[model samples]
Target chain A: MSPRRGTRRLRLSDPHRRVRFGLAVVLTVLTIIGGRLVQLQGLDGMKYAAAAEELRLTRLDLPAARGQILDRDGNALAYSVEARAIFADPGMIVAPGRTALALAPLLATSADALMGELTADGRFVYLARGLDPAGAQAIMDLQLAGIGELVEQRREYPAEWTAAQVVGFVGQDDTGLAGIEDQYDDVLTGTPGQLVYEQGRFGLPIPAATHSLEEAVPGSDVQLTLDQDLQFTLEQALAVANENAGVSSAQAVVLDVATGQVLAMGGSPGYNAADPGGVRGDQLANPTVSHVIEPGSVNKMITFAGALEEGLITPETELTVPDNIAVSDIVINDAWGHAPIHFTATGILGKSSNVGTVMLAQQLGNARLEEYLRRFGLGTATGIELPAESNGILLPHEEWSGSQAGTIPFGQGVSMTVLQMASMFQAVANDGVLVPPRIVDQVIGPDGTVIDQPGSEPRRVLEPDTSADLRYMLESVTNEGGTAPLARIDGYRVAGKTGTAQRPNPECRCYAGGGYWATFAGFAPADDPRYVIAISVEQPGGSGGGGVIAAPVFTSIMSFALGDNGVAPTGTPSPEFRLTTDED
Target chain B: MSALPAYDRPQRVAGRRTEPTRVSLQRPVAAPAPAGRAPFVALILFVIGAGLIALLVLNTAIAADSFTERSLSQQIEQLRLQEQELQQEIGAAQAPAALARAAVEQGMVPAGPPGFLIVHPDGTTQVVGEAKPATRPPPPARRN
Candidate 1:
């Protein structure tokens, strides 16, 4: 090549152009990087940071323990225990069959079901809930690839069937499904908490990292007025009575007469709270407060109360009573046929004379009879702390037919629950003050604060003088000539009424072939009553009377109640009654 | 080293008095002559090295403590579970049915209506309820 000498320099490599080229390329890359940084850090900084945080954060739910349902004496009827819910990630599993085989024993789930769950699931599947934490730990020790556990709570019923109808049962999610559990669900379920923190790979919290927690507040406990011992006895007696009477079902309730608190309330064939799956739907309810039946001669007490309260009759007042009386297309007869006789007001009740009771009702009339019924808290809810209560069937006095007026006085046409019957006796037992039965004593907070729950306000239904006269008259029912001699506890001044009402047949809409509701309600040491117990058994297609079937059950339970509570029997003897005003 | 410092002090005075002589810190003897800050530098480096070692030890201890805390909490959880299990067993055993079954297994008979004996402060005794001898066994045996 020829060289130009005078041009100052020959172009060997063009160093200036090369330097410009390198600068242009470097500037282009720098501009792109700067723009991207601006986009990320300045333009959408909050959104991108939040997204990254979301990917790095893990949230755990801390479940606060549900409250315990304790009996009046501080024994747990139902409580919550720590447990775990086992789950699996199907995608992470190596072999579904092998995993199922390894987990079946620990989970107590069939391998076929586990295999189905593992093979047919998407990403996540719950294998079992409410597994004991120790068992869950054992499963985790197996180191199955996809299995994990979560915190949960399981309901434990220590008393089991003893207070099942009163305490109720909890379902899969630990929600109360029946009884007190259902009634006090809100008070039993506590607040849940959340823990959110930054997590590293494998979802473990980084040490000393920032985290936030909202403390969980536990639920308040419900202290029931149920005496565990008395309740157990009540249920046992009902079952025995049911077996003896060959009845369909039976119910009984014991109440503290002074405080209107339910010491025990239950029924036969009670479903065990621990295993509610095998129980029938019909037996799950607290039938003592819910089921309504004609009270028969027990309603005669109200009739007697009406007559005595209105000054129409005294305990010794004599009247001419016949064997049967016709009233509006029906003839009502006494339990036994007899000629006309002179009878006292006490005689009518002690004898459970249907004709004599009708005679008393005729004197008081329907309006006054209805007044006494309403005052006794019949035909309405007893307001006990139970669900599905009935305000028993009662037509108004104005709506009563002539036959109804005759039958209602003896508790045939009118219907009431065993609880209502007890409250009637309770009114007499509590010196004429009616205290609506209460099943809850207090609500205890988690932090040891006690909130006292006052029961329904007491109302005076009858005069104290009338109640005294009524108690004296009822004392004769357990006497020699009276109906319920079996109900008498030795050395105790027992008083009660017997009921043998004919159940209305659904097929025929009449009392025929429907059997009877044998019921006996009473209170012991009748002078100053402390407790009132109402016992009833439904004998379908049976002929037993209340004094025979229900009185035995009553005696056993009442004996226990009186003895268990250390109630002293009066040393005085029961007074004599002039059942018939006869000239010997 | 003491004689060297004395000899360098004279040179330092001569340097100030005659003309500005360039000082070289690489010369160890001359470095301490004018600045006298070598101990301060050594002290700072010593502090930094000691701090680094202290941090390492502290970190290791904290890591160990965290591990201990984890294991202890796990043990406490296990103990709590064991206590719960025992309590559950006791509760189940305390149930009326279980107690009745156990009593039956021991050949115990159900007492008839319980009777009370009152011992007055004066030492007089009187029975309240009618104390009857148990004529029948427990309900289960009777049923059989």
Candidate 2:
């Protein structure tokens, strides 16, 4: 081989330089890739990490239930039950028409309406709310796309009409509308919860993925002082009285004399708490605390009580009471025509003589009379847990007209609720100590902690001896010759007063040619009173009087209450009462 | 030259010899044996590969169990819903109206005025009011 040929071969076979060039190119590309990797993994890592987490994580809201209303005996008056609400993902629905047709029968809706809901331009829409589990399951069994059921709580009232007025009702959104339900809505509503979890495809929670949950807190329950059985009895009695007397409406209330705890309170024409939309607005008002009427002869008790308390007269104080007496410009007369005769104070009250009452009220002037009425809790709301209580009409003594004093003395010008009337009697029956009425007994928390409700403090209205004297005088009213003879119980000594007030004509605002309000207020076992009952009938047809129409209602309710409470009759005979004086 | 010097001259043969052979008297060196570490390294690599394969299989089993747990959780939710439904039914059955209806169907009537049996402090009893019968005789005890 020649030296020139060998040199040419050496030039071609020198491979180290080519290898060095290829390695340089590879290192450059790898350096660029490593730099990019460092930037992505270190500099903006948190941003990318958040983005990735968002893709796999989901959040959900959990709803809590409203509390329940229970009677004193733990019977459920109003409660919440688990229910299902059906919703649709309109965006995910494939065939709106077909889905609507499949769901219409189960949802109890028109197919066209359902289609309209399903075709709306939204991600979610409510097809139906508060469906029974069975109904919801029937729809779920179809397995239609975009259809789902959400667990919800529905308010239910088990005792439909027993204490409907007091329990009130809830709106479609579970918000209380009236009565105790509205008063304690906040305490009755519970706290909601939240859920944070990882979601897989189809939005289902991924197994073994990150998950967290916050449990819901349930609401507290309220227990009222009312007895369901007694409430039912009172409602039934009022209903019967309303029907038998042909009255437009009637109301009754019973109270424990010692504690002032209302046992039963109801009014006729009550609305069902389950369905309250059909009831009239006026009827929705609880007549026992919301409606007011002139108390008529019942006001005589206050006048007599005041007189006895002030030492104005004794039980045997003789008075020459005429059949008619003039006060200011108004002439007050007895209900029946009678001659002027002399009688004792007990006889005057037992007969419920308006003339005699006016004479005694004159001795205790308007100032003292008004003061006594105020003390009896008239002209003010009862402050019950129920909503929309009325403060009855009582003008100041300075606002009285010439005849107002005369009419006010006999319960003609003043008006008060039935609860106030019962309260007045409760004061007398409890020996002149007036206790504010209580309707709620306790509140039970979700954790089973009991919170006792504070009862109202007792206020002294009259002396004990004066109350005793008044009780003795009032007992004569239910005797044989008294006005409320029908109010007598067979084995118990009854004390009560009868009232007949002519309702003011709506057009003329006068007491002429208008309907009448008949009322009876009393207690049982006059010596040892346990319960105070008051009944009132409005606008009774024909010639019905309080002694005839309202007295029997009082008797039936009082008897039942006494018997149910295990109160034994005194079994002692009542003292004799004098109907007439020696000069008669 | 003098008849090609017969002893020193090369002989003609069928195949050609490229080089002349030489012989040495010293001991022959042995050819290099394969490295001893190579087989050991190969065996370790095989075992590591098998362990990795087993790990992958176990992970797959765990993933399958996760699916079963999800299915069981779904079943538990369904059972809870069924229990709520049953509770609602029981509540409805015990409602006042339903109970009243059932009572009427069972030949029961509403109670009359209640009477009390008063127990005195001395433990003696006295009946206050008339005690009314609760239910009428069962059709005069139908003759067998």
Largest TM-score belongs to which candidate? 1
lDDT of each residue in A1-584, candidate 2, tens digit only: 69989987776577886678679889999999988888888887888998898889997777777888988888888888778899999999999999999999888889999988999998899899888877898999999999999888888886777788898888878888888789888878889888889887766667668899998888899999898878877876777777764588889899999999899898897888878887887787678998999988988999999889889998889888889988888788899888787878998999988898888989999899999999989998777777878889999999998788988877888999999999999999999999988898888898989987767888999899999999999999999689999998867899989998888878777767578888999998899999999888897343577899899999878877887777877767899888668634
TM-score of each: 0.90, 0.82
Q: DockQ of every model listed?
A: 0.36, 0.13
lDDT per residue for candidate 1 within A330-386, as digits (tens), equals 999999989988988898899889999999899999999999999999888988777
Q: Distance from true position, residue A335, model 1, in Å? A: 1.1
lDDT of each: 0.86, 0.83
TM-scores of the candidates, chain A only: 0.94, 0.90
Candidate 2 has an lDDT of 0.83
lDDT of 1 by residue, B1-144 (tens): 233355435555555554354443323233233465567656767888899999999977876776777689889988999999999999888877777777788988666665678889999987776767767566642111
